[model samples]
Target: MTELQLTLEEKIGQMLICGFDGLTPNDHIQQLIEKHHIGGVIYFSRNYANVKQIADLSYELQQMNAASSQVPLFVSIDQEGGMVARIDNDEVTLVPGNMSIGASRDDELAYEAAVICAKELRQMGINVNFAPSLDINNNPKNPVIGVRSYGENADLVSELGIATIEGYQSSDLAATAKHFPGHGDTAVDSHYGLASVPHNQARLMKLELAPFIRAIQAGVDMIMTAHVMFPAFEPEQIPATLSRRVLHDLLRVQLAYEGIIITDCLEMHAISKEFGVAEGAVKAVEGGADIVLVSHTLQEQVAAIEALIGAVRSGRIQEEQIDVSVKRILALKHKRHVGEYEQLTGSVAEQFGTAERKDLIRQLTEKSITLVKDEQQLPLNLSEPTLVIWPEVRHHTQVDEPIVQAYTLGPALAELGANVKEFRIATHPTEEDIQSAIQLAAQYKQVVVVTYNAVSELHEGQVEIVRQIAARNDVALVVASTRNPYDLNQFSEVKTYLCCYENRPMTMSALAKVLTGQLKAQGKLPVTLSPEYSFGMAAQ
Candidate 1:
């Protein structure tokens, strides 16, 4: 497909990847394809049900697009695994998160995990994965991108990111190294408001921008722009997604990257609330973005495409510029054979979530679960009644999906045949909730507290609860951070601490085995906990 052959509307559509609310094709999605001529479709947790349902939907959408447009849709999903995963069902295989992979210090495991994810996505007809988040998670207070990142160290993140990119692309899936420049050193979540990394170019090169530079060298297929602002490079207060200095000058010219540059969803608050999605879309393309993603709202999708067309017609954006982006997009689709449509035979593959994949997940989890410290509480006494205080199931951040059936510490402990009494606390526990939990701990001989991102001030109530519980001399206390490892920084008094990286089912199960003496804690810390407990500190 040549750029000269496409009409203005068609070219505009080719740069868009929109999302609609449905398990199957609806009028809104059809209109985006037939009327708007969108280039791709993005899948969230809402759009998925099971393997067969989503697979069928992918096949049908491809057929639908084939009838009207010559270009094939880039069916993409944020299957970054762990907390940010969109596809989670009984039929699909799940792997340990990036932080966990980093903890294991095994680049082979990282490669294998991505290979598994790519194969599953390919079977479902998903050609692109917004994965291998190369963000260096240096800020513990960051509401988003905590465990989703590889680690705090630039070299570890770079090596593992390169492994993931190779794994995905080797399987014929386009791998996207995301949140360009970096999104690691921020406190604010871009989903809610504008966040900035205030470091100079020298500091960014040393830490934040290290992984992306390595990724470009490794020939990453796509680089997704961050909604984060970099004051050192980009003079304007606008995000890197709309800053030509950041995307074009820094990423394209300086780094010499020549791949597809896709923007993170324009509907995110950093773009949507600050600049309207329509205007943001226009500015994104002008800033050298190859694809502008509007993941929600039909109105925004339509308006953004219309705004792009208007910009072209009014000479605000030159037609020649549009040609460059479209050419890159088409060249990638052709290389990946993304336009080829093939229907599933009304059945899923036997290898989707086989025991082999399940065992890999188990091995990865066993290798990743870290015992940050253990003074005397090595193994729990299963003979006596144990109290498990866990945070109630909920979304930890705006990026995390609302979990339908979250695997908790209580159930994991129970599966190991422990005499367990479970107590649920609000994610952000209140004074009343804390008081009740403290009082409840008096009844059990052993107390285990599972925290979810307690390092963040939003969940500071958890730290207070753990401190009060630890002060009690009667019950032996244990603290485990299920999401972020930085929780140990908050309550250093707790002698027994474990870092699970994420609260996924595999992590919870592996943690259960570690607590019961069935598995050993061999995983090291991927990120620095504190001055005393630095990176690689773990009690084996």
Candidate 2:
């Protein structure tokens, strides 16, 4: 009877889904389910070892869910390719990104991209994909959510973002359009710090809200709120994540979004620095969020859930409000066919680097790779050895080492029979290292400095490396800027700049193709980079 003993607090706790870390589901997780009956869990790349491993974990998670018959669990992952993807498709398959798709303006590609993402994730026993970032990256200095967005134009963002959702919906995976009203307009990364966009309701509606509205109309399963302030809308101390006006009135009543209203990670800085994590979860739920997300840090999840239960018991939140979220979670779970999807892995693993995928990747990457400033020194007469200086971004705490197998690209480049010199530039390069790069730049007929925003700090060491090389020689800088073109300002002397939009294999292959003249730079700058690198700055 003690096992069956219940409280409204515990019932409310069951409706709030959260995430866990590591490979195995721990006793802490099991206790949360069997005791408090937490509603859901979000998976990350770290929780996965391979396809088979995830299938087994999904099975176990479901088994735990069965212990309580309130509702099925909400299982999710970040499968958005480009800068913020989780699944490892062996470096063969990928989508170029929302920006690339938007630049192409091909609705067909949008459907194809979404279908591919959905199908692959579905095959691995995944039920949800936090994708189709509905942010409009009009702000050039935004530390996060750059090329992850579709483009700067609101109308285009609306069009392509909706198309992406339809594509995901086609394959029966619950697709989420996230960081509502929008996160792309902010100049800060919410992961490490709080961010705000000083836009009025008029500006937000015209720019940021366009994509989310379009996505909702196209049958999005959920809308994830941003942890950003909307003073003109809320007009006070409330971010969209904890604002009833932003979530219910604007999104639900006005935009007519009938789907689940999920909040972004409760642990993120924008929320956490304000109220502690526990109170933040309650605030998000009270703000018209159907599901409060306590993502990241298992310890925080425990504390937040406890706090939520306490709040509900104390009557700070009504019991019916908790039921409302659980009902939404159940509805999404059933619609997603979480119980019916085949438990097969590696069915399409061989599809990576397939002719079709490669072709699409090549095509999309060529379109996305922006040529902001070039000396017109491209189509380089590289009959001679070009000193290729490669920069390593984060020191490897890599999980995909053995599965990544041997280095694929470096050796493959050798087969192309190009004399490529490699340099490993860490996060911070000393003056001696700068001189070495300078000296090397003098010797080579063309110095190709390959850089990316995804791996390295956009404004840190790479800038120093590029500036030093450009100063010394007529450098043919092949900038592999995966996200922001903001880095271009620091390297004005770069003879040829390429925006590969993503650092994934798709974008990588495109960069290689364009470098070898197998392809041409066709992408317009999707966002403004000042008057110098404005939208459509590249050659027509």
Candidate 3:
């Protein structure tokens, strides 16, 4: 059990937390557990089917490792609730996201959200949740951490993030505060490429690093490093995930975070593009990460493990350092009692996605609906023919290709007894598509344009389409299903603007209720969208 007792290969294995390719363990992952002795496994959306399946999968993984290694695997997932949920089905109750909780400004609700997610994860045998993103969302152009973060205010992010951490830990689930020192100010998506934070250490301490500092104070179990460069910290343009000054000097020495240091996925282009996977893994450990996360490709995982082993053998990375990481990982595993996975007491089917949980989701969604602008255009006359212009934008993540789906708003609106005409277009509507929508808007008494994340420059077509339709139609309303409400800046003359904050089914249903006057808009803007319409602005 001592550092001197463990083999160099075992020590290297303890540093890696890898991802496999299937819902169940494949031959490759079995080899990884048996031979590599990897310390953990991180699950993705592809690894889950339902509650029972996830539980079974977690059990299988634990069993696979229990027979081989002394330490149990750290089964982790990105179950951050709203947009970043990996397990979404009828069996799992999806809570509102961080920003939604921040907008509600209810610390209890934030805690409740984390508790719900933690209970569900623990029930499924998942011990670690890479959640409660502590990044202060200071940049509107930030493509990745937009809705994942709580809000722009450091105090708000700190309060809600600490509440979440407390809730998760209360349920015996390890909560990881992520993308340190901060990923909020970057315009680039680190998943696709490297991002740089040009602010000096003073600015970072005040703005970007505030929430993380608070999270460390709140005793977050883990901190995930950002794949971003801080010029003032290192000045080498290397990511914080691979910078000793940022991780060892700042996080350990200055901030004094005692929890495990985990790197963001090494397969991400931010790391993989600049340094090969194996090299990045070595650098991350040398830089002071306790866990080097390799979230894809078995080849890369094996290579990284071999690289770490070689680094330790060559004295580039000392065995004492490896022992330090393994000891921390083992301590967490022992503290959490993460050994052989045990099935929950009751039927998982009945426990998960209960009617009460669904109702809670509905209530939370209702509270998060924000009416940013209104010219007395809401409570739409359901008796009249309404044109529902649905611009279907494909949701894109860093790892996955664009996922396309037709807009369901038209059908949902039609169910409300409105004579609805549905006009569907790609996210970027063609010039013809815009003209056609405009012409069709003339036929209806009212036109409702539905936009998904249209605030970004990438979705300018949707913005243009709204502008043209609003110019011709006197009763044009824009419902922005986005995290940021800055899209309203483009529609200065538009009569109505509604911010749903997210495009989930619960949020969309809440929007319908708000439009029908069944639910009042109670949520204030979490982040300032413009000078005229500041944070805490909402129609009462």
Q: lDDT for each of the candidates?
A: 0.89, 0.70, 0.83
Candidate 1 C-alpha lDDT tens digits along 54-144: 8889999999998998889999999998877888776889877899888888888888888998988988889999988999999888778
TM-score for each of the candidates: 0.97, 0.90, 0.95
lDDT of 1: 0.89
Q: Model 2 scores what on Cα lDDT?
A: 0.70
Full ranking by TM-score: 1, 3, 2
Q: Which candidate number maximizes lDDT? A: 1
Give the candidate number with the greatest TM-score. 1
lDDT digits (tens) for residues 54-146 of candidate 2: 777877777777767445566788777765666666643567678777666676777777777776666666777888788988877776787
Off by over 4 Å in 1: 346-349, 395-397, 404-406, 430-432
Tens digits of per-residue lDDT for model 3, 66-91: 79776788899988877677876667
Over 4 Å off in model 3, which ranges? Answer: 1-4, 344-346, 393-395, 399-407, 414-417, 430-436
Winner of 1 and 2 under TM-score: 1
Q: Please give the lDDT score at residue 195 for candidate 3.
A: 94
Error of 2 at 334 (Å): 1.9
